[model samples]
Target: MLFEKPLTLEDIKKEPFIIEHIKWDAGPKELMEPSIVPSCDGFIKKEPLKGYIFYIDTMGDKPVLSLMRHTEAGFAETLAQLDDMPDELLKEAIDESKGKGCFGMYPINEKIKALLKKELGAG
Candidate 1:
């Protein structure tokens, strides 16, 4: 179920992690693991997702760095382009949510959203 007034990206940012629970989808939102796959094995800033494994890097500077599996940018490139998602998809979700008597549900990811705003290419 969704709230009458959806949570804004700012509000969602306060949380440790953001999730996008797609309704009626045949898959989970995203599966995370402690270790990144082969791509970022040496601790990289970014890496793309190939056939199966999308490596995440943690440089070990920040305390939470070691556990850093992936960044929002990498997440999108690997999975679906949340930032560049097509409008038709959004419309379809809205339709489905309404049918389920739900307003909508989604976790706000600032980094991805910011990238999306930039990708919009207007101001």
Candidate 2:
């Protein structure tokens, strides 16, 4: 019964964990709080979590699932800010962590991958 038909964003939203961890902000008020960030000054300059981000990628012959806690600023911008280094430096950093597991990216289980393929109409 895994993906009896092609899936869409709405279908992916059916996943339980995605709904729980991702917080959506309906307005500016949800973006900042004086209690958590004491220096909020009654307003936040940045956009807050707008929606859940569930993206899938094909790595080699397997499917990888990526769940990002998305904000109005978006995930790409955040990654770019964190990866402020030249290509050579990035390579060295990656090499140094060769055996360590990557954070936030995981290979989908075979059964789930099969189901997702069907849902994506790739099966």
Alpha-carbon RMSD, each predicted model: 15.8, 14.2
- Residue by residue across 33-122, what tens digits does model 2's lDDT show? 222343447644443465543332323333334333445564321111112123343344334434332342322233443444455343
CA lDDT of every candidate: 0.28, 0.36
TM-scores of the candidates in the order shown: 0.19, 0.23
Backbone clash numbers for all candidates listed? 0, 0
Q: Local error of candidate 1 at 98, Å? A: 1.0
Cα shift from native, residue 35, model 1 (Å): 28
Off by over 4 Å in 1: 1-81, 99-123
Weakest ten-residue segment in model 2 by summed lDDT:
76-85
